[model samples]
Structure formats: structure tokens, C-alpha cells
Target: MADWISRDDRLPVPVTAYGPLHLLARHVHRLSDTGQAHEAITAADAYLVIARIVRDEKSVRFLIQGKMYALLALGRVNEAYPLAIALLHSQRAAGSVLGEAKALCDLARIHLLGGHYVDCMRNLARAGVLLGTAPAETDRHRSALCSFATAATAAELYEAAAGAYEQLRHSTSSFDLVHAVTLLYWGLRLAHVGRSEEARSRLRRSAEITRAWLETDPDPTITAMHALALAKLGETTVAEKLARSVIMELRAGGSHQYARMAHLALGISLRAHGFPQEARREFIAARDLTEEGSRPDERPIIRFELALTALDLDSGQASRDLFETVEGQVRELWRLRLQRLAMLRQARQREETEAARARAEREILRDPLTGLGNRRRFDLLIGAVSPAREAPLTLLLIDLDHFKAVNDIHSHSVGDLALREVAAILRAHCRQGDEAVRYAGDEFVIFLGGDAEAGSEVGERIRMAVAEADILTDLHMTVSVGVATWSSGMTGEQLFQAADSRLYAAKWSGRNTTAA
Candidate 1:
């Protein structure tokens, strides 16, 4: 902590005797945003102490949120949880829907950092629902929702994110940095789901807006996002220059995480421009910069991009595995298979004993707890079902909403039974061609031959079936579903990601809803 928290360095002193409180508070905010969490915490705490002493609820609200945010950034979850609960209580007591929304968003953010995606989405959904039902949503409420939506996007809930950004874009009169960031996210999400042309258009608009806004508001984040968007829009040279500038600025500021992101963005631009080796180098640096304390949601995308760049690094096994992920491109895949066929030898094959052992090993793919296939089996199925080759393949990624809370409140035994019941419902409703897999604890996936509409119908049926099941004595299960059908230009991984994003959208729309 900094000396800003000394007894003599109180907010009252700053406001009345020492310096301007507004300037001090702004400085505190800048500290928090620029990754100086410990310093920000001290300043925020000092302000909070003075605000409470003076009974300034408004100042208290702002200062407390800043304090919690700093605590969150520092990975001090155990401390942040109780404070979050207290904030929610105070917000409700004050009859401020906006404040309550902020509290919920903070809790959701904590859950997100803890890798409790289901819990995060549930809290986020509740907050959105609460603010949405309010009789009058002023600019403040809209702004709060926009922030919530930004969190949703971070959680990979694209539909809710787009809706939130759209609302904020239309509602807010000011075209500032936040607006620029929102448009960038909206465009990025659009690209994630295979709307490349429209996404490019949006990205171009985002870049234009950001370029103009940069004259007054210079931020590395805006610069990085604009560069990535330009890369996506095929202006790789321009994107590289912009991303490099961002990396330089971020590195100078000690913003390692953003610097890492900038590295990855530049790698993407380099790769698009046919510089795979350069891209691999950039990706390597990006991966090296990641710390254990970095946000959980960022890890997956970072690793995914790193693997994509690894292909050009002459990495054999990993590259082969990654190449299989290029689903739906039949001719190329067949060519690769043919290239490997010459290496196969049948006469030196295993005997019946070895064949039986192999079969037994494959049989272990079923999840023992829920009687569904495990993640390995899910991966195998996705590998076989190419999205680019067959547009009919649909993926439905499902998450049991608030399952962690159930485990915490009831018992793990009850949670297991609830999972079993949910699995049974899924098994009962899945069509003949569908395969249900328990991807992870409280998370499941379904791969089927169907269109998006059929996938949605099946997802809804699964939801209804689980809601109707009562095998667990004290447990109830509700699931959120994200559906994605294979489309041209989409890889298997991208298809799965699309479904995952929809799952969050479902969770955001009040869990148990299906988003396709």
C-alpha cells in the first residue's frame, strides 16, 4: 500500500485543506486502470474512510467500488467477496437499481476471475434483468448496463454483448473512448460467429472512430483493438504499424498484460500478411508475458492463438493436432490423409489381445459420474465432424447454471445427483444422431447433424427436460445452451467457440434460455 492511506492523508483534508478531491480521485482511478492496484487500494481506502465519516453516500459508493475493483485486480477474492455482498446490501437499502447492478457486476467479475463462468453469468443475468425491468432507465443505468455488457463480452457472451453495446451506442450522446471500445468489441464478436464481411465493415467504422478519438483520448487499449480490427479487415501493414505503436506505449507504461495482448495482435497481423515465423516469434513473446494473476478469460484465447502460430514453427505433433481442427475442408484433409496412408502397415498390426485392449481403452471415454462421454470423446467427435466440410454439423455447449452455488449450499453428493439428472435429461432428448458429452464438471456439449433451428429446438427440449426432472431430492437443475451450426469459413474450434458464446448469451437472457 502507498502512503496515501496515512491518517493525515484523508479525503476531507484533500477536499478542504490540502488539494482538490476531484483531482485526487481521478488520479486514484488512473492508478487503478494502469495496473497499480495496491496503490489504488490505499488511495481508495483513505477516501472511503473520509466519505463514511462525513456520511457522503455518493462518495462512499464510488470509493467502495474502486476499492473492491483494486482488490479484485490483486486476486484478493476472499476479501472482495464479503465487501461485494455488503455493497449489494447497501445498494438495495439505498433503493438504487444502478448501484445494485454495479454490485452484481462486481460479484460476477469475481466469479469470472475464479473460473466460475456459470456463476458469473448467472449473477450478470440477474443484474441485467433487474436494471432492464426498472421503470425508467436513465443515462446512468444505461451506462451501467454497458459496463455489464462489456463484462459479458469478456465472458464470451456475444449476443448479450451486442445488445448491450447497441443500447449504449444509441442511448449515450457522447462519442468517447468507451464508445470506441464498445464498437470494437461488437465487431470482434461479429467476426467470432462467422459474420466476417459485416464484421469487417464494423471494424473499419471502429477504426475510423478510434483514429478520430485518439486525438483527444490516447489509450493503448483503443490502439490495440483498432489494430486488430484492421488486421481482420485485411489491412495487415497498417494493422502491424498500429499494433507496434500500442506495444511500445504499453511496454513503456509497464502494462504487461496489454503489452502481451498487443504482441498477440501483432502476431495475428503478421500471420495474415504471410509472415508466419515473425508471427510465431510475436506469439512466443505474448505467451511469455502472461502471469498467473492475469484474468482467466484471457488464457484460452491467448493459448489458442499461440497454437495457431506454432504451426509455422515446425512443431510436428501439435501442428498435426491443430491441423485436424480445420474442420469442413474435405479435399485438403483427404489429401493429408493420403499423404499419411503410405506410412501405414497392416501386417505388423497388433493381435486380438492388443485390439481388445485398445477397445477397452476407448470404452473409458464415457463419464463415470454422469454416464455421458467425456471431454476426450467430445474432442474426437468434433475432429470427425468438420464444420467447413459439412454445414449440417451443429454444436451445443451447455452449462449448468449456478451449479457451484448448489454444490456450496447443498452438498457435493446432491450436486452429483443433480448432474446425473441433467445428463439423463440430455440423453433422453438428444436425437438419434446426437452425441452427448460431459465436457467438464457442470459443463456439457452435444454434437449433432442438424441445422441451427433444429439445434435450438433440441437445446430447448434439453432445458425443459432437465427442469422437469426431479431425481435429486433437494437439487434443481437449469442449463444455459449455446448453439452453433457449421458454416463456411468456420473451423471446428470456431464453431465450438460460437456455441460457447451463445451459452453465455443464454445465461445473460435469464438462464435456461437457449441462444443459437
Candidate 2:
């Protein structure tokens, strides 16, 4: 097992039965960082095998992350995409907020690779929300911040990318390798924003840090980054020579991934020194190499550089052709962006439509005057009650005594108030798994959970509560209730009819009474 991972990207690999698997996972990451993508994938697969045998879900996610990074580095974005999503879901299932945030960042990187800037920004925003409370000093937070910066840069949000890098630079308050890498991204952000002097300063610092590290371990990716820093600083002669040397070494070692970066570095240097023709050739070579193995988004960037170089070339036809090609690609990218926006708008519309429909349904089922379930709601509740599946059902049918006289002697408004008061009393008597409805003008129904005895008790309590209420005191309003319990063979309609007959008995036997 490697003692540590680059001293900058180290993670704790616990000494346990799965220690070998962890070691393998770290090796996979190291291989990917060194541009040995194929070897990294193979190592990741071996790690996955051991993790599966141990049934370690966390280990599995780590392996998936490593393999996915390797695949992405190899420009196998379609293959990496599913793995990115899987990592997100797995972390969510594990209920690790930090892990889920990291997974979101990984998914954002995949979106960046495909030039899906809108989607990339959305994922980065979500990750930021998740990491809002995470400690800044942790490796997970630093990793997520790095991803945010990279994605923001891809989306052309240079200010936001620079802000993230600034946070990363201040996280440890030390001049370490992590800070060095952050400086490089910070420099890239500055370059995009046209602050060339500031960009050169940051790049130089990052290059110096990496140069010191390279003396101990000759990492080609680090070497390429140093060349890029030199190129960006406008050290044209030395930058061009170093870039060429790095490209030759990487290509000879079959590390075309870093070779592409070296080519870009050389192009940048040549362009800065007024060698447009040489710059154009280097840019074209980089673009071709990117098409072979780099991320889909990288080729267009190289083409953009190529177009810029072509603007100063002697051949007008070549210049127009290059400009046209870049314009067409940009137009297609914009079209895709618009299509995604339209789909999102349509999805939001569908959700709003569904919500409006649900609100309308609720309004229809509710009584406007009493805020209680209406007749339609009563019917639906009764239809759901079955003797075969539940305990004996109880129905309480209630009516206001001399309710018409109250409406006639008093105002209709007073009668409405009295009805609302009765509904309140019925609701107070309702228990869990019970339904209360305003069945008609003055009649109410409640489906109770138990036998007729329980129904009669609730019905009596509602009767007394209504008789004593101060509402429309002069009208002396009181409610009579009828209680009916269903037998195993009785239907909902038969039970309702029985309750109605009992209601009639209560009216005849004295008002303000319960008849069971």
C-alpha cells in the first residue's frame, strides 16, 4: 500500500480487514492522477471485487468514485455518467450529508465534461447548499470547493470560480500542495476574466510549488501544469521549449491525456509571442488529440483558440472556415441549452397544473360555510367503509331541532352561524379514523370507529355541547342525534337508513336527545 497520496490528496485508509481494498482504492486514484487511466480502471475493478465480498457499501461507493474518475479522465463520459449518479444515490442511501455533497460535485464535473453548463451549475448549487454547514478544514469540503471552482469556470462564472478558489486558498492558512493546486485554478479563473498580471502571479507560485514536488516524484501531469503556468506567464521562449519537451515525453510514454495539455500550453505560448501560424498548428494538433481522448467540452475550447489564431493568419479563406466552424458549434451548444431550458419549463408547468387540479378537488369536497366535509365527501367516506375488512362501523346522524324556525324567526345569517357551531361540536367529538360531514342544510353525519354504544356516547356529547353553546343564544338551538351500528351483512346504505329512522325517533321523543 502507498504510504500517502501525493501528500495533498491523502485520505485515511483504516487498518481493518478491508485495509487491502482501501489501499487498492487509493492506488486507483493515484493511477488516475498520473494519467494511467486504463490501469486505474483495472485497479478500481479489483477493489470493487473485494468490497463486494465484504459487503461494505462505503467501500463500494469509494471504488465507484475512483473508477468513475478514471473513466472520465479517459474521456469515457457516457460510462462515467451513470457511475456518477449511482454514487449520489448510494451516498444518499447511506445518509451521509458530506458524502452526498461530494457526490453532487462529482456529478457536476460530469456535466462540465459534456458542456452541460446549466446542469453543471444546478448540481454545484445543490452541493453548495449541502455543504453550507460543513467545516471548511475537512478534505471533503476542500474537494467539493475544488469541484465548484472547476464547474464555475466551465460555466463562465469567473467571479464565482475565483471566490471558491479564494476560500480554498484560505482554508488551511498554510502554503501547502493543496493551496498550490488551488492557486493554479485561481490563476485560470483570473486568465478567463482578462486579469493577465494577477493570473501570471498565481500561476508562477503554483509552478514553483509543483517544481519542488517534481524533484522527488516525476509526475507528468504536474510537469504539464508547470509548462502551462510558464506559458500563461508569457515566458514565450522558455515556455515553448518546456511545453515541447513535455509533449514529446508524454507522447512517447503513451500518456496522451497530459500530452494534450502540453500541446495547449505550447499553443498559448506561441500565440502570446506573435507567432500566429505556429500557434494555429499547435492548437489544431491539440484539438485533434482532444477529439481522440479528451472530454467532449475540451475540443470546442481548443477550436476557439484555433479560431483566435486564424484571425491573424495570411489566408482569409482559412480564417473564415475556422470562424464558421466555431460559430456553428457554439450555435449548436446554444440550441441544446435552450432545449434543456424548455424541458425544465414544461416540467414546472406540468407540476403547477397537477397542483391546481388537486386544489380544485379539495375545494369541491369541502363545505364553504362550515369548512367541514360536504355531501360528496360523505359519500366517498361511506363508500370506503366495508364490514369485511374492519371492526363494526358506527354512524351518527344529527339534525338541528326546529332549525327552520330559527332561520325564519331570526336572520338566515344567524341560522348559518348556528349550523357552523353544530359542525364545530361534531368535529370536537370526532376521533382518529373518524369522518364528520355536513350532510345537508341542517343535518350532519359522523362515521365513528366502534359499535353503536360508542357512537351514541359521542352523539350525546355533541348534543349537550350544542345545547349549551352561546351561539345564537336567543334562538335556543339544539341538535338531536341518531346512532346506528352496521352488522357484518349490512351495506353502507342500509346503515345510513337505520340511522335516519333513529333520527326521526329522536325528533319525536324530545329535542336535544340521542336515539340509538
Candidate 3:
């Protein structure tokens, strides 16, 4: 070993220093994987100094970020946050978009592990947008990072991450090992969201990849993930065996995180296999190890799991004590959320109140019964516009073809429902910037934001939706629509008049079509 080390001077310095960091990261990851978090954190600190001295800033940043992730994984979130935030800020300042995205992704993962779902979502969204702007060369790393972040948040968000990973997978145009791991992450996320069959399929593919790799170079993390996949697939015996192997490897190598995760997997497998006593012991050990190095918030989940296990063990007092602690923490979290909600509600109310006041002021210029812009408001708007600023605008006038018959055939209740249904159809079909109003008892008007062709399309769509509405299942209902565009010298009133005349022509021609 000494002779080989001396002979490999070219491979020694950078490889040796970085090799330990890699090993430490893998160890921390395994400890996290196995639920031996106490041991993982103790081993993780040794990599910090060497990681800082790496010549490549990007690689070093990722190394430190991975350490922070491990810290969080071990439930050491408070310890992770300051360093994570500083690294993220530094990456952002350096204009390393991909690095910044990765940092944010890590921070989000910490929040997620701590069960801060909302914060996790916010950070994931930010990271996603930044990662979108990242160059293609970094796509694989970003995709994996984002997938992890998304999976940690909520199962529903995993689809987005999966889509990103798919894009990366296709762009890379290779059957990379990381792609298989990503598929496994996506599978677990799918299971969380109740897509069991699809999850199983993906997990099987992931297992195949890991198995192939393990044939040549066995990695404990890969084995651990395979165990999780097997467990998810309901292969309890196989999962347990794999988990045991992973644990042995971790113990042999003094790898904390893998051991912790392996313990967690073993506990799950035991519980599934009806070994309650053994399962409880493993769960307790896993929980204790996780809590040993984790943040206060992170500890709650571990505590919660432990409490549940205690309940299952019929230890009433222990369970009750754990519940009380959980309750207090939950209440604090609720209070903070409520405060934020209250502040948002107050701000929204203020804005709405101001909007209501403005609407009230404007109401004076609208027709009372029809809620349409009164002639005065139209006159004011048209008069205020200079000829130089005038652009093409279309107006549409609509009329219920047999509204009087509707009121006569149906009671006023049905008649009102019919009118409201038509109004809703109009509202739904209209463009966002367009305006629709009840012009009178049987007439409606629309102010279009664009040219005659666009207005004609809007008029047609509204007519179709109204015709299709099931408001009067017994009666066949339809409307006459007319569209007219303002020419170079036309006034707004002239436009309305032309549209109205065309509407009458439409009623005369067919009583159920648009006239353009």
C-alpha cells in the first residue's frame, strides 16, 4: 500500500484530499439512509476543511452543500441553515446560477426534512426557475437536485421534478446511472402520491440498475436505495436482506448515515413482517439517532415516530408524553402560519376595500339595472382620446332572441336563471381584458380590446357556449350577436350603433347567429 501510494504522486494530492470528502459524503448519506444519524454527524465534520481547499469553486460549493444536506439529513437543520444560507448567498453573488439553484435546492431540502412544507415549496419554486435558466451542461445535476427537493416537499410536486429529470435524461442521451437513481426518487414520490403501480415499475427499473452496478462495485447507498425500492414493492424478505447487507457495510466502514437509514429500513421491514418487538426497538434506535444531531424542528418528526412506536408498544405514559411535546410544537407552528395568513388577509382586505370604493365611484357612470357603462362614461372615454392615439377597436351587441317568450313560458325564477347562465357563459368565453355588461332587459354589450376578427371570434365563442348551456333543457335557447369595428373616422357611439343595427339584422335573418 505504501509503495503504491508513493508511486502515484500525480494521483495522490487532489485525489486523496477529495477522496476523503467523497467518502465522508457517502458515509453521511449512508448514515442518513440507515437512520444512524448520530454517527453520521460526528463523521461529517471531518470533511469541511479539505472541501474548502478544493481548487474548483463549483465542486467545492457542491461538497459543502452536500455536507449541509447531510447535517439536515441527520436532523441538524439549525446547524445546517447558517452555513447553507451563506453558501447560497455567496453563489448568488458570484452569479453562479446553477450553484445558487443547488444551494436553494439544499435549503429547501432542509426545510422539507424539518417538515416546513410551505417554506420548502417556496424555495423549490425559486430553485426551479433559476435551474431553468441554467446551461445544458449542468442539467443533470440540477435535475437530480430539483427532483430531491420536490420529492422532499410533497408528492404532488414530484411530477414537475420528474418532468425536469426526463428532459435532462433525454438531453444527455445516455443511460447514466444517476438517471436510474432519479427514476427511483420519482418512483418513491409517485408512491407517496398514490400511484402505486407506476411507482413499482420505476422502482423495479431502479433496482435493475443498482444490481448491475453492485456486481462490479458495490455502493452502500445504492444498496440502501434498492432496499427502499424493494420495501415499497412489498418484497419484505428481499428488502430486509438487502437492508441487512447495507447495515453491515456501514458498520464495517464506520459510516453513520447509511447505518441510520439501514436501521430505518430494517425497522420498516420488521414491522411489515410482523416482528413488532424487534421493529419497535429498531424504530426507537433510529429515532434516537436521528434526534441526536438534528434541529429542534427536525426532532419533532423523529419524536413523533417514536411516540407512535411507543403507542404501539402499549407504553401509555411514554406515548402521552411524546404527544404532549408534539402538540406544543404543532401549536407553535400553527400560530406562526395563522399570523402569516392574518397578515395576508389584512393586506388583501385593504386592497379590496380600496377597489370597492373605486368601483362605487365608477358605478355612477354605469347603467343601474343593466350594469353597463352609461352613455356619459362612454362619451367621456371617447372624447378624452386623441385622434392620433386612436386604434382599431370592435364592439359587439348581443340580444336574447326569445327572451320575452322565456319569461312567458318559464316562471321569473327560470327566466332569471337563464339570463344569469348566459351572462356566465359570456364571462367565461371573453378575453381577460375584454368587458361584458348587461346592456338592458334583453340586451348585452361587449367592448373588445382588439380588431374586428378577434371580436368576431369572441362573439362566436360566447354564442356557442350559451347555445350549449343546459339552463333550459326543455327549451332550445339561442342569442343574436353583432360585431362592428371602429374605422379611422368613426366615433364610439357610431360603433355601438352599427353593432346594434347588425344585431337586429342577425335576429331578423336567423335569430340564433352572429352578424359580422
Candidate topping TM-score = 1
Candidate 2 local accuracy as lDDT? 0.76
lDDT of 1 by residue, 379-492 (tens): 888777553484478888989989999889988998898888888888887775677999999999988778888888898888888877775666667889899888887777
lDDT value, residue 117 of candidate 3? 60
Cα RMSD to the true fold for all candidates = 25.2, 14.5, 19.5
Q: What are the per-model numbers of colliding residue pairs?
A: 2, 0, 16
Worst 10 residues of 3 by lDDT: 294-303
Model 2 C-alpha lDDT per residue in residues 1-516, reported as the tens digit of each score: 254666557567555633346666777889998889999999888878888898877678878888998998877999999999999998887667778888887897788778776676567666766666577777777877777666655554444555676687676533355445556655754564456888888888888887887788677766776777777777667767778777877878876656776887899888888888888788877776764565444565566667767776755887788777776775575455455545434543554566568779989999999988999999998887675756768999999998898888888999999888888888888876687899999999998988877888888888888878988546567888899998887778888999999999998998788999
- The candidate with the higher TM-score, 1 or 2, is 1
Clashes of 2: 0
Candidate 3 per-residue lDDT, tens place, 352-462, comes to: 566567778789777664445655665665464343446557788889888888899897778877777777777676674566777677777777778989988988988
Q: Of the candidates numbered 1 and 3, which has the greater TM-score value?
A: 1
Alpha carbon lDDT of each predicted model: 0.72, 0.76, 0.66
Looking at model 2, residue 235 earns an lDDT score of 68
TM-score computed on alpha carbons, candidate 2: 0.48
What is candidate 1's CA lDDT for residue 77?
A: 89
Query: Model 1 segments beyond 4 Å from truth?
Result: 1-31, 43-50, 133-139, 171-205, 211-223, 244-246, 255-262, 292-298, 313-318, 322-516
Q: Which ranges in model 2 have alpha carbons more than 4 Å from their true place?
A: 1-21, 27-55, 70-86, 110-119, 146-162, 171-238, 241-247, 254-277, 295-298, 315-516
